[model samples]
Target: MDKAISFEQVTHTYQANTPYAQNALADVSLVIPNNSFTAIIGHTGSGKSTLVQHINALLKPTKGSVQVLGKVITSATTNKNLKAFRQHVGMVFQFPEKQLFEETVIKDIMFGPKNYGVSDADAQQAAKSAMKLVGLDESLAEKSPFDLSGGQMRRVAIAGVLAMKPEILILDEPTAGLDPRGHKEIMDLAQQLHDKDQMTIILVTHQMDDVVNYASQVVVMDEGKIVKTGTAAEIFADPGWVYKMQLNLPSSAEFAQKLVDSGVPIGKLPLTIDQLATKISQLVAEGADTDE
Candidate 1:
């Protein structure tokens, strides 16, 4: 896969050289492939957030280097296109609803394009496109962002980021604090964006199920360092590493274990609800033949 972002021996501290200079990331290195959906999982202060911020020059590394979109972010030379780089990497934070301070939803969505010097008419066009992409209707354009439901507000904030038409979309706990329905909505929207736009997605979330269902790659971090990185099937096949990292296993992992104990002869250990359901059905059909 093509490399969208690369971190080479990168390290960062909160307050360098001060008494409070706590290390947030330690010699972390990884590559995020282009057009891939990758999830970064870790407990609080595990450096997942710090890692994503480096992709767009939002934060510079205290040591080592970060190369994003083929540009060395920590080079001695300055980036002439730092602004463009930021536009290329759209970041949506946790509880994105908090980003909606504008009076109207349309205005809020247009903020990014407007800041990037797009004309008013073009910005509005971008806003419209973004709204459609995020599953919002034009009727909500004039409504107050503050008055919308939590899920609606979250989508609106995502629209704000989408209006920039970024190549890479980085989300920090995008479904945080949302109910199950709202969480599903946000994730479905992300899946749609990835499917339709072929955009690279880097999701920082604690939701293990999301990793199983959505992410193509899983990157696990602990104590300010990456502990494991692999595909969803590879990582979730065993609960050992997940437990060691102090992270919850996906429900599929648990279900598979139960099936194994029940003598179902389940092989390869599925990692999603659909996979589990299908495997169970197959087992039942096989058992029916054995009884005959």
Candidate 2:
């Protein structure tokens, strides 16, 4: 698959040359393929956010380079004419609902496209489409965004990003601070966008279950460096590595490990509940056949 984003030996330092200088990312190299759902998992202060900010040039590398959709950004690169690049890369930060400032939901959603020079009619149409995609009712379009519930406000914020029609959508803890149902809804919406719209999604999250359920690829970060990268199954197959990285296994994997310890004969660690169920059913069938 084509590369949507690439980082070459990228290092970012905050307050460089100062006494309090801190290296947020250290010699990180990665490639995110187009139309793939990638989850970046790490504990707080692990440079996950710093690393992703390079995708759209929100933060330039203190050293090395970053390439997004054919645009190369270096420490010395200028910010001129980056509008085109920004248009193709939409970033939804943590609690994006806090960024919603327009008086009405539709206006809030339309704000992004309008700033990008989309015609008023087209922007309005885009807003409606985005709202639908995020499962927001059209009737709420005219309501004050502040008047909506937390989940609704989050949807409106996400819709605002979707209205831009970005090719690469970077979600930084998009489901943070939401109820369980709202959490599932946001994740489902993300999957819908990935599956139906073919949008490349880069999700930064600490939720192991979300990573197992949604991410096709997983990147583990530690101490400002990528310690592991692989499919979710490959990454979660070894509980030791996860523990060493200061991360926990997805619930299914943890349960499977417990079953294995108790001699249940589960063949491998399962990343999802469905996989665990299948393995348990197979064990049951085998036991019945042996009895017969």
Candidate 3:
């Protein structure tokens, strides 16, 4: 697979040369493959946020370099066409709905494309399509975004980013504050986007279940450095590392581990409910056969 984003020995420092200077990212290097869903997990202040900001050039590294979507961004590099680069990399920050200030939902969704020089007609068409993509009703297009429900408002905000037709989508805690249904809605939408649109997704989240359910690859960050990188199964295969990183396994995995500890014959650690159910059925079948 082609590299969609790459970081080479990247280091970022906040308030450099000041007494309160803090190293947010330290000697970090990573590669995100194209059209892959990668989850970044870590405790607070673990540099997950700081790392994604570099993808769209929101923050520059104090040392080393970051290459995103074929554009190389470095501390000393200047005069680069950041706008054009940003067009291909859409970032949906936490509480994105707070940024929606347009009088109408449709207008808010169209705002991004318009700023990127998309024609009025094209922008409107894109916005309408995006609204549909996010499962928003056409009737609500003219309604005030602030008047909508929290879930609807979030959909509108996400639609705004989708209207830009970015090749790479970066979601920073996309479901930070929402009800259970709202959380499922947002996560399902993300899965649909990745599956249907084949968009490269980089998700920064603390939800281990979301990572297990959606992410093809997982990256664990700690103390401004990447401590581990692997597939979901590989990362969770060893529960000790997860605990050491101050992270917990998905609920399903944890429960499966409990069953294993209780002397149940679980073949492998399961990451999802379905997997766990199947393993349990297998164990029951084996026991029945043995009794015969």
TM-score of each model, in listed order: 0.93, 0.95, 0.96
Task: Tell how far residue 171 is off in model 3, in angstroms.
Answer: 0.8
The CA lDDT of each predicted structure is 0.89, 0.93, 0.94
TM-score of 2: 0.95
Residues 169-188, model 3: lDDT tens digits: 99999999999899999999
Candidate 1, residues 1-292, lDDT tens digits: the string is 6999999998888889999998888999999999999999998878898888888887888898998888887734366768877998999998878767889999999999999999999999999999999989999999999988988999999999999999999989999888899999999988988888999999999888999899998999988899889998888767776777788878876778777888768987777889888888898999999999
Clashing pairs in 1: none
Question: What RMSD does each model have against the real structure?
Answer: 1.9, 1.4, 1.4
**Clash totals for all models, in order?**
0, 0, 0
Q: State the lDDT at 111 in candidate 2.
A: 97
Which runs in model 3 stand beyond 4 Å of their true positions? none
TM-score, predicted candidate 3 vs. hidden true structure: 0.96
Over 4 Å off, model 2: 289-292
Please say which candidate is ahead in lDDT: 2 or 3. Answer: 3
